[model samples]
Target: MVDPDRVLVPTLGRPREDEALAYALETFPDADVTLLAVVTPLDAPLSEGGVLERSEERTARARASATDLLESVADPTATERIRVETADGRPGTVIPQYASTEGVDHVVMYGHGTDTSGFVRRILGRGIAATVVERTDEPVTVLE
Candidate 1:
């Protein structure tokens, strides 16, 4: 496959596969690698203040996770081409939407399991990677 201009890799606070990030950084040194984390709104009935606080907390954690993953890889050479971002929405929706609208030439995602919970996997069904493939026309590469 041709080298992508921009690549998107979606992650949660918990990563199912750590190598996805490393692979992108290694394989596409010239491409902009965006580590995107999705913060899905909680459905719990809480006061406005409580909801806002919770949202802020989730977003912070999401950014931290992306930063941690990049640090874990310890590749300082690719730092300039990498960016971590947090988006507000369901992973299944936001991941695909971002890839389509953000001029992403490729998407790299972990296949099968997601996060650290079997419960979440069941709720999300086939997985976020599968969702992206089904929803986006961009080339998707799934890493097991």
Candidate 2:
């Protein structure tokens, strides 16, 4: 396969995300890697003020965590090519949208397992990576 010029990897603070990232880094050393995290709106019902504050806090935390994760795995020599980004929306929609808008050449992500829980997650669309694959035209490489 041709090495991609830009690769999008959606992370959800999961080990599988790290695995997919590591794989992408190794496989496409020259590709610009965009580390994306989607922060879904909180499901809790609360006063508007409280909701706004909580949402801000969640977004900050997710951005910090994503930065840390990217820093931990990114090679210093490639720092210029690694980007940390976050969006407020469902990962299913946002990931693909981001990839398309950014002109990503490919996507590398982890696949939901075949076990019972994984199956349920996939059915419920909790596996955002899978959803991203379905929504984007870019080639996707799914890691087990």
Candidate 3:
């Protein structure tokens, strides 16, 4: 069987992402997997010891958490196949851009259910999963 060149998993501080990634690895054992944790910075600059500062710290923490989470799931020798990339942009935009440039054949994103509406949906417009699918030539797999 042909293994995918890469699988991109977009994370947003979700704990379940680790489990989903594990499933994807098991399903495609030979494929390289990348766990992406996007750090979308706030519009305003963070004040000293303020909410924005805390949020930034949280973003860093999330990335660390993701690395730890992924490490727990896979063997150390095979861990080289797993990568973690962080970017300061929208998930929808970053994911597709990475997929196009990285020669990714499949993108495995966590599905947050089919509830689209409000500013979140309007701003994201069907979100990272749909955006990646529409923008990239590769196939996208939404893991619930």
In terms of lDDT, the best-performing candidate is 1
- What shift in Å separates residue 144 of candidate 3 from its native position after superposition? 2.3
Winner of 1 and 3 under lDDT? 1
Cα lDDT tens digits, model 3, 48-97, are: 12254667675677589778877887778778888887765666677788
Off by over 4 Å in 1: 44-53, 112-124
Sort by lDDT, best first: 1, 2, 3
TM-score of each candidate?
0.82, 0.82, 0.75
- In candidate 3 the C-alpha lDDT for residue 139 amounts to 80
TM-score winner between candidates 2 and 3: 2
The C-alpha stretches of model 3 lying farther than 4 A from their native spots are: 44-51, 54-59, 113-125
lDDT score of residue 111 within candidate 1:
75
Candidate 3 whole-model C-alpha lDDT, 0 to 1: 0.70
* 2 versus 3: better lDDT goes to: 2
What's model 3's TM-score?
A: 0.75
> Where is the poorest 10-residue window by lDDT in model 2?
43-52
Error of 3 at 57 (Å): 4.4
Question: Which residue pairs show backbone clashes in model 1?
Answer: none
Candidate 1 lDDT, 1-144, residue by residue in tens = 789999998886544546888788778888999999777667521111235567778788778978888888737877778899989877778888999889999988787464438786666466667777899889988987
